[model samples]
Target chain A: MSNGQETSQETFAALEALKEHYSLPSLTFSVPRQVQGLVLPVVIAVVWEALAQTGILPANWLPAPSVVVATLLELLRGGELLGHIGVTLARVVSGFLIGALAATLLGGVTGSSPLVRRVLDPTLQALRSIPSMAWVPLFLLWLGIHESSKIALIAVGVFFPVYLNLLSGILTVDRKLLEVGQVFRLDRVQQVRRVILPAALPSYLVGLRSGLGLGWMFVVAAEIMGASRGLGFLMIDGQMTGRASVIIASIVLFALFGKLTDLVLERAAKGLLGQRGIEF
Target chain B: MGLAGAHRAALDIRGLCKDFAVHGGRVTALQDINLTVRQGDFISIIGSSGCGKSTLLRIIAGLETDYQGDAEFEGERINGPGLERGVVFQEHRLFPWLTVRENVAFGLGGGRENSRGESVREHIDLVGLTGFEQAYPHQLSGGMAQRAAIARALVNRPQVLLLDEPFGALDALTKIQMQEEVLRIWRAEGATMVLVTHDIDEAVFLGDRVVIMSNRPGTIKRIIPVDLPRPRDRGSYEFTHLRSAIYAEFFRQEDKPFAYAI
Candidate 1:
């Protein structure tokens, strides 16, 4: 029994060694994951600031990280940055909601019915091919160069990905599951609500995230073309006045806000699906 | 036939024909199929691959509509799928988003009142999945998921339960265990079951009559009654004899050209 115990102990130790060898490397210092993610960004900012301080890199054309931060702080102090951010946020939110709603309706119609798919899918595919910038002039002429045109441009950008993803998502719902719906004698509406929508949810969530990313992109384009206010306007104003720090600050804010919004969407998707591996 | 014929028919199919369109031409899947399933009878359909055994089950389930001839349930024409006939597919087909309880409850549909007042809990317990009510489908083993699917089919108290190769995916041990579980549920529920399988032993073990079929332009070749008492011993001579009888039918046609052989 003692000899058996010794052999078992040796086997256990070997198993432990094998596990350690195969396991992903854990951090030695036990730093939180969120803080760990910040390390690279902090390192880059410090290096850029040091280079500027040493006069190795010129600050006028490409502002130092600290100068951009200082400029952002100045804008915050004047309360102008908040207004610009609010305007941009409102535009993106409205455009995203509109685009998502329209896509859901049309995607449902075309995805479920082959007849509608044959009638509309080709035309939608053609419309999707035209570049985002091409829509800017048409949107301006149709909706005017105000918030409407900007939102419209973002809506058009947001529409395609969501629509396409939802369409394919609905189209590809497992025929087996639909057969279950049929066997259970679920009506047409019940089939849509109970089977198709839930099965297609993961893909739909993917579309929403991509649509949101595109919404951010188109909002930038919309603002840059001609905006009285917004981060895009701030960038243009800074460039015209030769304030490179302010321009860099606006760019930084856009990056920050875009990432934050996407994070919100991802969190919502996670909460809705609960631990399923979302492809996006 | 005398024993099964004594009971009133739960499902009656006559002159059933099914065709599928291939690249250039139509291929016959099922041809001149005729069968009668009596009340509370367990019918197992055995065939080789491409025998259209599943196609027959689908036609009875009302999932296939373009078939020729009549399939009636309890003297009513099966124009489409109805609540009275529940089907369990090879895969569990549980909605991934719903829990086991939710998936079973879905058989009740959104707002349709359960007139019998039978609870989903009863069906879950019937399939021996009582403790797993809150579990997701992916968390369960193949046999366990299949059990949940059986529970979902039974929850509505369907008069005719159709199983299409339900245990075809399971390992040997799990398959045997699931077969026993199905037998128990069938006895308890008293629903007429038509199970499609390629396993001859499975057909002998559970079926009241095994309906053997010929391949490609599939047709019913014979229906042999299993008069053996339960619970059946798979090792018994009578059991092996029944199983081998079904096996001999498949190989008997080996020398003939398969499509034209029918």
Candidate 2:
């Protein structure tokens, strides 16, 4: 019995030590605050350089990271890349904002009232089934190959996803929560603003993230169809001249911008939804 | 004025009927349910599941629109939900995005005439959530969340508070604590409250009058007046006697072998 007690004491001590060690969480090393912003591009540059130097492929087809940087700088100096970036950014932002705003308002109306949902559901369903690219020819016919056509293309791409998600989110809010609002004697407007809007936010943010990406993709496709400026135009222009560097540069810029936008949205979402009660 | 006000009942619910046209058939949830709730009275409705206790509370709160009912408050007919009636559901149902303070304020309305920021803060403190005003509902424990829900319901200073198994989701210890908290709040607020619960002990402990209900097209089986004092001892003879009586009634209904009768 004495030996058994001693062995159990030793086992208990070991268990305690194990628990302490497991409990003592180590501090994680965060990306350096200043250098954090530059890490992704820096890693890309290192990989690009390594691939180019290895000579696993032809040089003409695969430019070095330095070569791409120099070409980007040259394009900036020539006032071409900056202008294209500006045009593309402006078109995407405006079109996405318009589509998102309209979809949100319509979604709210449809979500709250079954009558409105029934009226709008079939038509919206049919429209959503048609691809955004399918609208390009018709949009071009109506608006011509101008900024309007590009905006229309991006807006069409963004509309369905944002509306559907927002509507569903609003519809699925806990009925019990709404009853709380009623008990308080909250007016109709107050119910929507205070309860429905906040309840639908996480889903709305998701819709925004997806809608923005779709809008960007549609804009590039529209630009490729025929535009004098923007990233897609730069790629088309490069393809016409057999200049692979410009096409590759444009692709890189698209990726960089998309990543930046997503990062900003993710940061905002974390700030808004990270609180204890809020569900993502 | 207090005694006179207590004599004058806050709510008089008569001939309350509610039915649903479910896929199976017409289901009668409540039938000819009549009840009177005095000002500052604590009443508990005890019944089996599907006994329509919740439906009755919802009708009083005006959350159920399709009910045929004559529910009046202060001698006035209640057509819809007003600021005079408040409800706490089984689930806390606190809004996810808002902090405890904001969730409480949501019922206060956005009008200029309505009390604003500081008054909202006062109500939060009253519910014993002084430090947790900024905490979200999900961050709170089940009991705390229910407390927050009660706080939210009481923020409007409604005359009638309807609780539909508010502490049903809590653990035993937490439920006991919450029941004490609710009783304290109800006394402090001097609000007429109708609580629906399955626990016989709970119904006996907190209620001034326990209304036992029969199942399916539910009607009041009996209304047992609890003559016990405030903060009544759970282990006392009266408490056990009342609890056993309610339990006996519940089982009596359950054990009826009607189909086997010749």
Candidate 3:
């Protein structure tokens, strides 16, 4: 009878341990997470509007949020705002895709092979040290002041972050995991496809995000140099014509679109990594 | 001989010596080790830390080949890792990106998509992890993750399975449970297993024979055969007798003063 009781206790303890292991604390929020994030921004916007209404600041230098909104509406009604946004979005997307593809191929090669890393890393590092504006003049001369030069400038900006992050990711893959690949008798291609690539994916996604950010920054610089249309052109045109509200509207659009694209990339990355339960 | 044919021994190791190159000087890790594991036998190798028992197992698994030795499996020269011998590490080492199902399927390699899916499911069921097929490694308890690791190792249907302290990380209760599970699996699969561990009770409980090891240029000190019947009781007199006998070997080593070579 005593032995039976002890066995039952032991089984109960084991079951309790297992239950504890499986139970991860769920996070519950009264207010939605996105709404909580917006509280501070909303407060700042209200304060700024109040200050503008009191007439302490001049209208030409720092336009009110309302004034910027009106200017944006006027541009929208004229049907030119959408065209500028579309053209700017196209340049950024095209440049980002090209840069990411080339970086992934090169990063994979250098990350996996020591010989390739030794041969190419130094030259790439030197190229990365050159400023983004420095490439503008060279690219303009080489590809001419058109869509190609602008796209090339954006690609160079996108290249370094993606390449560096991916290379570091591959290099830092756990040695024990590599040993698992070896013990399983995985050949070179099999090792890359199954072990190294999957291990480096989280870092690769991170690189893509930062690379897209740099692509946006470079597009602005590209359009400022020479372009007939785009948000950057709108900003330049506003500056020349001394329209503070228009300049502010263009800046606001840049912020909105940049954040929108990042959220989209983040959503896609979450879908890819949802099963693994990795945090963004 | 092929795996299907009869063999003299599952693993044959003789005059095995290994060295490590540390800061330009060579440090001997294992020296003149000799052991022959019979087919369907469970051999437990016990040693203190840095005893090089793990190095010996790695050599047999073909993960470490830079050594002077004759390590053969079923009369074939072991040059590199092959599918015939599977290894389970201390850490589960499940790819975090892969689900339980996909991680097990990885053992069958990336080809023959349709045929191997059945085998992957079979191994997952064998480990009693059928319902949690889509779960990631972090979602599992330590014991469950290790079970998945064992399933992945056995998915290839290897004749020999090498375990490097496979249950060393589990809690006491879970460790006992996993030991019983392993013994049951050994009987079911009839695969020759070599388990390297530091636990005396564990070595006595699971092994058909226990090989004692000594450190500082590691070598096999003794090989004690266990004649206990199946489901051996831990509290039995015979069990304690064998456990103390192995403990005596380590106690004897402690009597001598520490010797340093510098």
Candidate 4:
């Protein structure tokens, strides 16, 4: 709750399980590997800067990269941007926690039992087909235009993907592997812990990442509609005031935060799976 | 000592039948299988594909439960999987998520015999995979992975080691090397081994008695004793003769194609 580190690590662990299942290569910890990913963004910045300097594009529409950087720095010092980022991050993390935990539990139950899967799966699948965005208005009405509503909306949006992925993960585990568990004479509890959990990790992680991405999207929608103290509100305010630089700065901040969280997740996954002799 | 008593069978099966409900009616996977395995003896079960050799092994390991008639371990009626019997499949079946050492250690974790008996390192070294403890299943060659699986099974100190075609996936050279390794481990441990394979030479090379199985609705056709000495040469006439004897079961029916031609 205090920081994004633990939640991101959990997601990474799921991803690690997934990568291990697929036998995917993990990111090597190297300076070059780190530096390589940034090349494209740098190139885009150069192009943007060149176009701005030549005045080929209107300044208001496409502000100078330097101007955007200065605005970003100004916002950083004032502590205003951090406040918004903090608020948005808190919402995503909490919402993600609720969605992921519930989905994982439910998924485990349903995945292990054919009767439960038959009973619950169809209704959930029907609900999943209706995009999470459609639930925003209903959520707003049900919980009101407050933090609860917004967080609830994000949570609702996040639940299905993780639930579905986790379910599939459990369902699709190799029977042969389970047979191996049987030969070892693992008790039911040990079987779940040693065999089922590891085998289902990949799908669970895919669900988490999917849910996380959806949660972020819904948070933006929830904030834009009602909230006053989040990045989405900041963007909406920028639009209203015709402050393109502010808008662009907020966008860049969003992108940077998203990338940062994802990178942390990727690293966490590598560590968790790497320990198991899975590279990823 | 005064009076020597008769030794008990490591495994005893009588009228064991396994039938699977298929598309419509039930299909017999195994029929009227009667067998007895002596303590500390290596028995190889060789059969053509779909002969239910693997199914029979699974039944003995207590991985399969729906079979009829008697299947007992050391005179106790087998019901479920037990630590006293360790089974290794054709595939290494090492958990990809576990390292070579961790996979080997897994057998020690759960079971009635969870005495935490042997050192994991000792088993790994015993398999000659000392250096690759950190390696994953995907990183290992087929032979190495099989060794890891063997180590995992042996670590439990099971009274009977059930191997379902343990070397069926290897290249010819690696298979020979692994055959010898199995013999070394078999001698060292002196546990009862029942290895199921389609390879006739493998059966003759490793088994004290080669059990030949007939095709679908499988039943034991014959049991040929391989009276060869240690480290039996593949090129030797006696070894080849014993191997051919095991292979002969496949061609017992004259209308059937030659077993080797396929």
RMSD for each of the candidates: 6.0, 7.0, 6.6, 8.3
- Interface RMSD against the true structure, candidate 4: 9.5
The candidates' interface RMSDs, in order, read 8.6, 9.7, 6.8, 9.5
Q: Of 2 and 3, which scores higher on DockQ?
A: 3
lDDT at residue B164 of model 3 (Cα atoms): 98
Candidate 2 residue lDDT tens string, B85-114:
888889888888777887777777765334
lDDT of 3 by residue, A26-95 (tens): 5854568668998788888888888888887788888778988999999999999999999999999999
Order of candidate numbers by TM-score, starting with the best: 3, 1, 4, 2
Every candidate's lDDT: 0.89, 0.84, 0.90, 0.84
DockQ of each: 0.37, 0.41, 0.46, 0.37
In candidate 3, which residue ranges exceed 4 Å CA deviation? A1-33, B1-7, B112-116, B256-262
Candidate 2: tens digits of C-alpha lDDT, residues A107-207 = 98998778989999888888889876888889989999889989988988888789988988898887777777777777778788878888888888899
Error of 3 at A214 (Å): 0.3
Q: Which stretches of candidate 2 lie over 4 Å from their true place?
A: A1-54, A64-67, A112-117, A276-280, B68-70, B111-119, B256-262
Q: Which clashing pairs does model 3 show?
A: none
Output the worst ten-in-a-row residue range by lDDT, candidate 3 chain A: A1-10
**Residue B72 CA error for candidate 2 (Å)?**
3.5
Model 4 interface DockQ: 0.37
Question: Which is better, 1 or 2, measured by lDDT?
Answer: 1
Off by over 4 Å in 1: A1-19, A22-39, A113-119, A275-280, B1-6, B112-117, B256-262
Q: Provide the clash count, candidate 2.
A: 0
Better of 2 and 3 by lDDT: 3
